[model samples]
Target: MFNIYKEMWDRRKMIHALSLQEIKKEYAGTVLGSVWGLVNPLMRIAVYWFVFSIGTRADNPVGGAPYAAWLAIGMVAWFLLNDAFRLSQKAFRSKRSIIKNTPFPIAILPAVQITFSFYTHLILLVVILIAMAFALQTVSVYWLQILYYDFAALMLLLGLGSVTAPLVAISKDFGRFLDTVLIFLFWMTPILWPVENAGPLENVVKLNPFHYIVQGYRDSIFYHSGFWEHPLYTLYFWALVLVLFILGNYLYKRMKPIFLDIM
Candidate 1:
């Protein structure tokens, strides 16, 4: 396992290069190009804000922050997570030409996808910070704690991607199945709804690994709460993420040699 990670680290430059190429190719020929990274998240926040805060009359502010600010915090993270989830599954298929032609490490493919998502996440984070500063009247040091959740999220995505990307390449139906499940996950994960108002379902929703990430974002940006404050959640999240990493690595290794056979 250590050797596997060591190999990936040694290819960091290649990963970075592929990630950038992926981003450029994705937005190639578009007028705004990468600027859409900033625009896409803002558009998503606008629609959700209008629907929930205006249409449904769900105007309760989270942690004293305006509904828009609170929603932005979670939406930025969700957008990143959602992008990683969907793209990672297509990592192998999307890179079919490159995979067949290049001798690069296969593991870096998912890393490239996740890095691309992280780049967009960084832009969205900046937009959200500006919104929070305007709406909340104050920003706290605790906001930096988002790095913890971001790291956790990256690990989870890479782990799951390692497993699913290979499987999706083997059978396209798996991709379709994953797409259906993500729609359910989107609603269940509390991005559009406030956990405080989930009533008896609050505990159940908290069980979702993503809930910790979404809640962590709110805690860092709005609640001013440190991660250490929630000892059990921190422990639980790391444990779950660690298990996923192990499972993902194991499955990825088993599938790696067979991937080209199917592709």
Candidate 2:
């Protein structure tokens, strides 16, 4: 464990370069260049907004805030977390050759993918901020609360990601399972439909442990409330995130030796 940490620290630059390489390669040979990352997510959000917010009788009216802005807050966070989760799972798959040959820490692979998604998410966030400033009239220092929103989500990702490492490495089927589970979770989460009161699902969602991570994001970014405003939710979320992180670290360390062998 100590050695892995030391290796990661020693190879920080290499990891960052790999992350940049991934982003560039993903957009390489395309005429639009880096613009494709921004454009692709924007298009997806547009289609989602068109279908759910416009086509259906969903209830996401924000009183004065436009539906687009409301949707951006949630979608941006969702995009960040979703992309990180999906891409990180494939980190080992893509770098299988390196893992097979090198003495490098396997941890760097997932970290690299997460960093790549973070870069793209940052670009989308800038676009969202500009859109909100011009269209929604809701851009202000109060919006800095989004920092906490992002922090909480990253914590959840780190915790969830650590746990997924062994699972994904040992079983390629976990990626398919991950996609299916995320799709199911998308419906369970109130991404399109706004929650009026917590409802029956709210109790179930609260127990989900990730529910507050998403809700806290929407609350902080769109609703412009400090997470401390919901002290109970704040405490509950970090508690779950921390516990999972510890357990994930333990499981990964215990299973990692056999993991590479099996892979």
Candidate 3:
């Protein structure tokens, strides 16, 4: 695992270049271009706000926080985590040519894709922060906890991507399977609803590592609480992350060599 990370560091320049190119290509030929990265999330938030707040009148204060504020925080975390996994499915397929022709670390493919999505997430994070400030009247120091949560999200992304990218490379059906899995997870997660409102099912939702992240974001902006406030959740999240990291590294080490032949 250390050696794989060392190789990624040794080829850091390649990762940066590829990540930047991917970001540019994502918005290429569009009128808004990179601005869409910011716009898309805002649009989604607006639509959801309208549907739940105005259309259905389901917008209610969650844990004493404004519905919009809670929704934005959850959506910001969800968008980043979702994009990390979704784009990771393409890590090998999208860069098969570079993998076949280049000699750099193939592990960097998922890193590049995740980093590209992180850029978009950063934009949305700023938008969320600004909106929170207006809605809450103040942004507390706890908001900085978002950095910790974002790091957790990155580790989870890299770890899961390490496993899934190789599996998807080997079998296209695996990618579809992952998509279905993510869809189920999305609904199960408390992005659009309150975990407290989940009642008896709250324990089931708590089993999801993503709930830690989503709730952590809300804690940072809306709840004004630090991650350490919930020691049990922190422990559970890190344990899951560590397991995924080990499993992903093992899979990548064994499967990376076969990627070319499969491609």
Clashes of each: 0, 0, 0
How far in Å is the alpha carbon of 31 misplaced in model 1?
1.5
Winner by TM-score between candidate 3 and candidate 2: 3
lDDT by residue for model 2 over 167-221, one digit each (tens)? 8888889878998988987776766656545577666666655566566666655
Question: lDDT score, residue 170, model 1?
Answer: 82
- Which residue pairs in model 2 clash with each other? none
> Using alpha carbons, what is the TM-score of model 3?
0.95
lDDT of 3 by residue, 152-174 (tens): 99988887887789899999898
Q: Extract clashing residue pairs from model 1.
A: none
Off by over 4 Å in 3: none
What lDDT score is found at residue 67 in candidate 1?
A: 78
The deviation in Å at residue 247 for candidate 1 is 1.0
Worst 10-residue lDDT window, candidate 1: 1-10
| TM-score ranking, high to low | 3, 1, 2
Q: Order of candidates by lDDT, top first?
A: 3, 1, 2
Spell out the clash pairs found in candidate 3.
Answer: none
Per-candidate TM-score against the hidden true structure: 0.95, 0.90, 0.95
